[model samples]
Target chain A: MVRLRLHLVAGIVLAFAVRGPAFAADFTVPPVPTHYVTDNAGALSSATQTSVDAELKAYEKATGHQVIVWIGDTTGAVPLETWTGDTAHQWHVGRRGKDDGAILFLFMHDHKVRIEVGYGLEGSLTDADSSRIIRDDIVPRMKANDPNGAVSSGVAAMLTTITPSYAGVTPPPAAENVAPPIVSGAVISMFGLFGVFMLFIAFVIVMRIIGSIRYGYLVMRKGAPAAKKEMKGFAFWDSSGGGSSSSGGSDFSSSSDDDFSSGGGDFGGGGASGSW
Target chain B: MQQRSWIGPVAVIGIVVVIALFVGSAYNSLVTLGQAVDAQWGQVENVYQRRADLIPNLVATVKGAANFESSTYEAVAKARASVGQISPAVVQNAVNNPQDFAKYAAAQDQLGSALSRLLAVVENYPQLKATENFQTLQAQLEGTENRIAFERRKYNDVAQAFNTRRDTIPTVFFAGLFGSKFNEKPYFKAQAGAEQAPAVNFSP
Candidate 1:
């Protein structure tokens, strides 16, 4: 009986010893990769790009998570503009220049649906605007597990909102044809109208100069004697009137000259003697 | 002589039984307390996860309201990123390493501050405040905070019991031998300046 009791106690102790470590080792929630794409977008403007980059960096610091963002026109093998229509594209585009488009993509590693917005469409459609639409119309649906529907709705809304901004700027014609708008005819017409107006003004000024010269010559030839008589009569009358007004007239003339000289730098010089 | 022999045998058996019962009860209680602690940890983790999950929507909503305030938006984004960056292994290490726990605490504090700033800014936006999704997320976050407080309390209770057992006189002897003494865990104490929820400040 003594041996049997001892064995039972030993067995119980051994059983507990075996289970204790295992129970202690078991932990909840297996470790997962926490890296997430915070923002991914098409070619963004410099200002928008700077803001997005700063936002992502701040996000990473605040969250202690790795945020992988692709800020450019292309996704992997396909252009961002095309990637929106199809998912098979893998080409990731980086910021190049004014012509190169960019996109902003935000991907949470654990989350199924990622957010992608076109930063290239800033003034036309802002980050805030796109985010609002997504959060309002798409994110709720996505959280409810309808990713396909959410994406479709988001894409449609974005396209509808953005298309009007590029009313005349046509889409890429073909693989090799990616030229911007020409607008040469409009520019030519604008310049042409300005040139014609300048020439018309010049013609009028020349005609007036010729007419003035001809009138001066005609007056000298046809009215010389009459003008001489009138001048003599006017001189006689001026001399009679000048005796009492000489001092005041001299003061007024001097002051007027002074004012003219002082104001003569740009405007007065052109008008002073000409008006007289 | 016959009576004395029976007394000796009976005395030995009683002593053995009493010793066995004492050790068994102690071991069983320790195990049960440990399990409770583990279960409470799960609840804490769940609430934390729910908080984390609420972040993107909150951020998105705030982003919509105040797009020009890049600094505030950046703060929110950084907090969200930090939450995402913290790996589970790092969280596990936090249980052992005080420094790791500090980092964890700091990250959580940043997120809380960012959320406060976000909510404060949301006051300027009546349209955003009226959004159904934003309202839902806000409600969920509030609920999650309450749940977190409850879970933290439960965890502390279990931890207190475990620590008491490991510190008491005779049980401390076994705890020391087995190296099962309770480690101190930092609680989510509210920051000094953090008062009422910022969401309450929304006028509309």
Candidate 2:
């Protein structure tokens, strides 16, 4: 009887031990779907998925860059960024050679979100940008226990920054800040001449006023101190020539015409992860 | 018999000496490659150590601001301690002992999983993520992780070279005789979950 009990116990332990690796082998990162929106965690509502799916599909169709939304449970027991990065790399969403893929990852159970930027999109979807989008747009929704809300708003925020141009933002011409017609050197030079002419007119007006005030002080009236006060006001216009045009920011909203696509892009493991 | 036939004896001696020299050169080459594999392992360990070292600072920095779950921090601490359990002696012999190598690799993998979980937990704490110290630590940890990945790849390459040399005809026979530890070294293969090649669509 004692030998039989020992054998039974040993058999049970052996069975469990054999099953352990078998169970471990079953756990895998979810495969990527053909669509841009993959909601394996069931965190997203079908309605939300439909809308997001359409939007993402249309965007990808218009521009080759791939932007995917993935919602899984707890990053499947792995580090969120690494897992998301690995997924993004595997999906190869962006254009093949350009490596412009990005994954908007949401670990629903973990309440974490990451934007795994590909090599091509690193300049546009920067770490700072991703972090800001997560902190500002995604975290609040996740905090409220709304994963879909978080993803939608977060995707919107990202789209707002997407210039339809390339990933990295470029500085505009100084002439653009000055005025719209300064694309050519001739136009820029003409604007410069116009600014000089405006300065000349103001200078002439100041001289006339000073001449009349001096005349009044010497021959017509005696208000030299008061006229001197008027001259101080004229000094304010001196610095105005080079200031107003640059300060107005008329073309501030102008963004790039560049669009993002995988272009066969790859990822060097760039992205940020956050939990709510 | 004192027959003055030195040519036969001299020729035999010279041939024996030449063969010894050839075997000596091959053995020396194997020794050098083995050392190289060891050095690569050192690099791999060094990167892992850097990552382990950064965790305390990461945990401390995260602790100050975030109201993150305590279990995550505990898990990281536990994993870290386990990783530290491997001694330098074991590392030196890990190449020769598959069991030791597996234990060491398992420990590092656990630490990686724990650290990643810690970072994932940190995601929910926006305030913590915003802090300068937390950001710096996060960057360092990520950087170290990448270095570890890169170094592990290099380690495997050198290990492959070393093992092949050891397995080559005469070296295989003489490896145990020299006792220079020129055995096969283990590759740093992350145990399941991390083993899957991530999904990708690559446009040419």
Candidate 3:
């Protein structure tokens, strides 16, 4: 019984120590792009792409509104717009802080069309307007098996409804860089830090043992103050490494100019979703 | 004999030190999580309060319009009253006590649904919708609704972390070993009927 309990305890520790990552890293939601139009479902042909792209570019150029479209086979189990909202946060779509991005999500296999309006756009493009666009403009084309016509006409109708805002002078070119994750090196280097730390701890323990053995006789004889000098000596010798590391850390990171990447956009989950 | 003589004291000291480290870390983590709950509760409260503050202005604006439904006005007032009715103690302890959180959430959700109904009613009065004050207030309310949703989502995430740390086996086992009183917290669930899309019965 004791052995069984011990084995169970060990097994539990082992399980926790080796427990894999919490969530599946499903790459279904791909990274966001600079230009509009991601037709993953192959729903749009070249001609359809050209027209849609032209409209989106013109829309962005005229006003800073970022209206992108996603064509996919399915939105999984969740309602089409909820998935789109989650993806919107990840993609950081629309102008930062302004929340002027809109996505026309088309799940081809699922036969769902959702118009996700960002918070900034919610004023001009109300739920009623989105629903009307779906009902009058997109659904008819979709039912007739014309995906391109549905998106094209749907885009055109949406453009008519959207109120334009000044995008300011569009002087700067869009910067595109695919950088690795921030903590990419930290995980690997952590093991080295841990090993050094553990070694230091072990050294402290050994030193304590040696000190007790050597100074125990002296401590008892002279009553505890005799080893003070020896401890201070050890402390002074060890602190320099810690001081150097922390001092090095005090200076800012070398590439401080562009450390963080984001457009400062926020999502409030105000959008209209629908299914055909 | 000499080495063996030191073994007991050394082992005891080493064990005590290791336990202190683990228990210290565990306690610190619990403290951090507790503070996180408090911080998020404040955030949720702030947004909820903003929504509450807008009610009087909205009510006044709605009242100015002629022949608006009194029942809708009554519902909004009652919902707002219920939200105010919940004791602050219950809301503060909401993280630990699911029942209290449920009651609080229900009241708040009641206010939310009533506000929705009220907004729907406002749609009938074209002149009211066109008013600058009414329009601005509508925009603010919509924004606040989104904020409350975001904050609630954040609170759930933090509470989940706390609960996971408290409930998971090895941590649970250690917490028991050390006699730590870490316990599971609750999530803020969406109000009933919130999942369904708002009725599209109204023709554009």
Report the error of model 2 at residue B169, Å.
2.2
Kindly list the per-residue Cα lDDT of model 3 for residues A1-276, writing each as its tens digit.
574466456545534542221111222665664346778899889889876876676666566567878787886775454466566666666666677777788888887777777768877876557766776788888888888899988887787788433232332333232324766566758768777689789988876776566566666666678665554455423432222211111222223332212243545455554456
For candidate 2, the C-alpha RMSD (Å) to the true structure equals: 26.7
Q: TM-score, each model? A: 0.38, 0.42, 0.55
Candidate 2: regions farther than 4 A off: A1-276, B1-7, B193-204
Better of 1 and 2 by lDDT: 2
In model 3, the runs with Cα more than 4 Å from the true position are A1-35, A40-67, A73-77, A89-266, A271-276, B32-43, B85-93, B97-99, B116-154, B173-183, B196-203
Candidate 3 global lDDT: 0.67
Fnat values, candidates in order: 0.00, 0.00, 0.05
Tens-digit lDDT track of model 1 for B1-204: 767878988999999999889877887777777677667676666667777887777767667674546687678778878877888887754644557767877887688777667667666777777877776566555444444444454455565565555445444445434442344334445464432222121222
Candidate 2, residues A1-276: lDDT per residue as tens digits?
Answer: 574455455444543443322211233645545456778888888888877776665555545456878777785555554566555555556765566667888877776677777777767776557766776798878888887788877887776565444222232232212333536787668779778789799998887776565546644353667656654554523432232211111223222223222234556555556667
The candidate 2 chain A region of ten consecutive residues with least summed lDDT is A244-253
Candidate 2 positional error at A171, Å: 23
Write candidate 2's Cα lDDT for B78-162 as tens digits. 9999878788899767887889999998898998888778887776887787676776566556645654664565566677666
Which has the greatest TM-score?
3
Docking tier of model 2: it is: incorrect
Clashing pairs in 3: none
